[model samples]
Target: MRHNKWWLLVLALVLGLVLTACSGASDSTEDDNAGENESAEEKVLRISSPSDIPTMDPILAEDNVSIQYTDTVYEGLYRLAPEGEIVSGIAKKDETEVSEDGLTYTFHLREDAKWENGDPVTAQDFVYGWQRAINPDNKSFYANYLMSGKIKNAAEIYAGDLEPSELGVSAPDDYTFVVELEKPVPYFESYAAFPTFLPMNKEFIEEQGDDFALKPENMLSNGPFKMTEWNAEAGWKLEKNETYWDAENVALDGINVKVIKEPDTALSNYEVGELDRVTLYGSQVNDNQTSPEYNSLAETSVFWMKFNQESKTASKYMQNENFRKALAKAFNKQAYIDVVYGNDSTPVNYFVPKGFVKHPETEEDFQQGSDVLAYDVEAAQELWATAKQELGFEEVTLTFLSGDSDVAKSISEFMKGELESNLEGLTIEPNNVPWSQQLEIMRNKEYELAVSGWGPDYKDAISFVDLWVTGGENNDIAYSNKEYDALVNAAKGELATKPVERFEAMQEAEKIALEDAAIAPIMQRKTSVLAKDYVKGMDSLNPFGNDYSFKYVDIVK
Candidate 1:
């Protein structure tokens, strides 16, 4: 999980080539560096990270960093709470009404909800944002993937066959919004909490044009915090939005995120109290396990090896189901986790992570027996031998894509050694790039085999399962299975009302995806961070929206 923000997924970006372009005054009333006399309540939550902030605009956000910032700045009809629950944000929970038919929704916007600019956030903001996302001209990668077929006319609009104006959402007045759904989406509330569903000021966006949310000066927030600082390499900061409706509950005066690319440097700062939290890696993790400062967090992200069927180097080999299975069974998950997570993570055989969701009917884990185990070296060898003969390839060289971080590099080498040593005539070439470049290359379908990861877009399993469907937004690997698509579609459509049937459908899709070895599951990620004891209100994992919500976060110093 890039919580990398759990997007192995954001899957990482910056708005401008340089971050210094957006310098301006912060929303904070007092200077953070004033003096030692600064009260604990004035203490900014300083954290460190290895990468740069991508985009602040949710429409273009695909990586974890972008989503994280947007989550801090935007408010939707609902906001994601600690336990992945959808709580009211811009919309009033008690007043919002869903019709018995489940096709119509009436939202009563909170009159107090205001953007950072002091303008009242109205129902029109949501309509504009949703329309922009659905507009084919915007060319959103997540619009149809996340909202299509759910909202009336949304699917057609995304297909470029219908006008965006015809989309089902409408605002009769400034405070009242109505939504018409083509079908009843079971997790629609959770969907409402996603960044794509976030509201944006129509006047602000139209006036700013393309630069609407590209920089600090151009951006406006309606959430717990506002982007007070954003100098990508220099780091960024979030000051409590004084205009936010729920600012009273947002405890931290400011959040200072330092871009410390070096793990050691970040740890050093944390030790000296310059930073409240810093991520730990390598041997540092092993030493800090029992420390109260070490915050161990699990995630709903599965970092996997996605085989590109459209790739040139080894597409022929990848097309063979046996070959894909051979590659999947060749690696040792236990060994991989030890090297990567340092025994802090669990090996995953299925796409959905543990703790993601429970079986609706039995209350059993959805992943209890979904994995197809073939860890035996002998079995992998047998399968590989057959695949090699059938493909008639004496030797094959396939490229591996990964992020350039230390852990990513280490895991890349480990997988290279494991697969090359286990399978005859298999040569694994490692291509390590900046996270953003990795996404670009994968999207371009340039590699034969890619190291990919997916964090759920919502609480539902379809967030991950739909990635393997034909033409899915995140299906950069070009893997396709019609039956898997059918199951996912059925779960979202015909079986949506039947909880047990929907759950069964999702489970079946997962099984098919795994058994087919569409993507080789590596490990479910859990981040290791050195969080000060003062840092509170953040959950280890969130099944909905961003990995972490800063809305109620505080430094109890």
Candidate 2:
């Protein structure tokens, strides 16, 4: 899935605008005194983010909220550039040499890069990071995907039968790193850019213990910016690291990120010239789109309904295939897109959002097929009837759990009304919970039906299709298909050697999953950013979300 955190990204952009506005307004009062030092240049840039930095430890941080913050503070061997191309970061430039069987990889690292604390960044850092992640005791969900079968003995290591050192990653010296894989991976370089694979400073992690990521002092940054201040409730700030090897190329002096979840409050701050950028939603889009300040940008992300077939609390009704299909059929996607998103979004038919992947061979555009469980009252009623008869029930009630966002609430209400009115002998209950609680429920498979969205980890079709692959950690829906799983596994095995073949296999896997109605995909989300005309260099190479490079951003005098 793409690392597109729409809400969180919007919050960050809005907060950037807010901080700029606040400083601008305050600057007027100190203009006389500040004018003299104006020639000194800006040393900090302020940004806003909606979610808190969950963890500073890359191995433990999996969500986009944490990934976005970490991306600025940590440097990977390779980093994605603004043009969505991979560039050398810590490695300088790695040489890939495939083994005879095409299952082994050896990477040569740069010898000069050093950690923020002045310790040399050796290939051992990468080896240690990989070991820590796959260690069974750590139980990192991301580690399962990142290491998994890629490294020899990794699966066994994760199962606790083998020592962490037994994993396939090894640093022969200070600069040579070798990786052994159980199968060939085509997107391995892209995978290296992911947060889970970023190197960590062992000494710092050990010293800080559990509080390593709690404050700026406890952490050591390896990326363009270093953590300066992190007020749990207020926000976090990043100051440009002058010691960064690529510091000369970095534009912003610093960036401050605020956590603001409420759209109206964010918009109010933006309108009052307290924010440099803000994101508008549904009706707010209409209110702001016509405004002189509005600047909307679309991104590739999909928000949809996830059915927990393995739910312990509400499993009986949700596990029923007919019930799941009925719920999907009851939703009018176009109506939701029209009424909920308007011109700001487009309805999604497939689970993988459009613009996520390109054909490996032809490089042709792959559009989402019309295999959606489209809204049809009559069809929904028919499916519901069949489900009622099969279950030998007079009535069935199921709850839809979602985060407590205004948009989530509205969509839940819309779904409830649609299902209740269209399907007989069915009750649709809506449960609104905090995002943290909602994530817990989804992870534990505690909800019957839940509202959720996934952004790609890398720009690949496998990222999305892998969700339903049997026991995938991200498979909150408890969807399991042996054939689908086999196809995905096969694709993963052949990804490097047979790129076109792998894509075809994945396409077949997606078709099978969708035909089963494993999950209902709703709309493709567009990230709308309302920025003041003067903010420039907002674009960064980070594929995860909006990149805050305030170095090049300047307030027009």
Candidate 3:
């Protein structure tokens, strides 16, 4: 952490607003600005989050908090545009070429792009970063989860059957980089815009060894802003990178963020000019819509409780799909939203959030055009009875792992009451844990059931749908089905180039999972924000969970 006046609050508001998010990059369709323009100077754009950044290493980032800090410093081949389009970042759009078959992508690194340390950013930098991410020895959570089969030999490398050098990405020269994918992936360019695809400074990384990315001195930035100070508990600061390739277009002079956990305190700070933006959660949302600063945006994220088929305790009945269906149908989705979220979101019966994807030919919403798994209480009871009869257990206590936050606990308690009352002889014992702890618990697959969500990393439905593939990295439920894997594989392989087939395959994959009760779809999320009038150009629709870009942000009086 750098010793300077810093704004670590970015994490506080960032986590509060974006980290809690479960889905990814959103299309910009809701902005009401008539080009009033949001800009800042001399000082930074002030935002608050409830937590500190967990890590700055892109390969190591699992949560949005870590991605926020690292993403600010790292420039990838592509960057996400305001409307959720793919724009060139380190690699210029004109210089990039895709093979006729879409199996290969070639990127030409811009000569003007340089690291914050004045070293020229090169093609090999990307090669090294890709290798490091896919290297099983580095233990990157996103490596196999995000890229595994997408990149040639990536799965083999993670499984120790092949070396990192075998991965299909390479740089023939400092200015030219080429990537070979296993198949045609229309969303691959959008994926390249993600942090996991960012380049690394090889020399600096090897010099710092394990200490790389831990401090300002050890980190390097090629993005529009560079970190000048980072205090884990105190705060962090980011200054505009003067040498950035597109620095002239950047608006902010610097960004100072602080950490504030309480909604009232954060609101108080925002009122006093101590913070520029704050997200109001739970009950804090009511009675604030009349404020000039109040703004709300529909989020692509969704919340669901994953049923663990491999229970550590004696709740083996979870392995039964009938039991899973019973639990899914027993919940009141609308009531869940009204109670847990103060009705800020909509009840969703499917895994993929609505408006996330569109039909190739008709342009209709992909989710709206598909078949849905119906939710009903009467059908739930029959499924529960049949499940119990098969398992020889009249009653079962399902252990649920959830967040320790006030709203999280309340939601869990609310669901427990609803499930127990609706389905007789059922017990839900929720073990509330901190957000970080809860993630680890689920990652380790140490819980019987857990509430978790995925924000898409890209615009495609596959971004969230791929998470449920058999043995995929985020599938902590220990749920697996050959049919599910087949449908998903078809979507990513044979159906990729054919947009209609691809959409249909994904629709089928989602159908198979939902029908089997792989996870309970509660509701799609929408965040009510007390956005400062001066805060402009911050992105809120990116489905990738990067809620905003600070480069063009401003704070005008």
lDDT, candidates in the order shown: 0.72, 0.65, 0.70
User: Where does the lowest 10-residue lDDT sum fall in candidate 3?
Assistant: 1-10
Sorted by TM-score (best first), the order is 1, 3, 2
Residues 1-557, candidate 2: write the lDDT tens digits: 23322211112221111000000000001111222442446733433444454566766655555665676788778776663567787875547566888677777777667778878788888998888888878767667755687778988998889999998888889888788888877767766676677787788888888787778999888788898877774676677787787788776666656665566766766666556666565677776677776654454555667788887766776678887788888878777765554546676767665665778778765554765476677887788888888878887788888656565577678788877878877688999775555656766788887766655566666666776778776676878889999898888775557888888888888888777789877776555556777666553223333233233344543
Show pairs that collide, candidate 1: 1-6, 2-5, 2-6, 3-6, 7-10, 8-11, 10-63, 10-64, 13-54, 14-54
Span of 10 residues, lowest total lDDT, candidate 2: 19-28
Per-candidate TM vs. native?
0.92, 0.88, 0.89
State the lDDT of candidate 3 residue by residue for 15-112, as single tens digits: 22223222221111001221222343254576655555667887776665566566667789987666556788889878789999887899998999
lDDT of 1 by residue, 37-131 (tens): 44655857777556666578877666766676788888889887886678998888778889997999999998998988889999999999999
**What's the C-alpha lDDT at position 47 in model 3?**
67
Q: List the candidate 3 regions with Cα displacement exceeding 4 Å.
A: 1-41, 369-375
Q: Top model by TM-score, which number?
A: 1
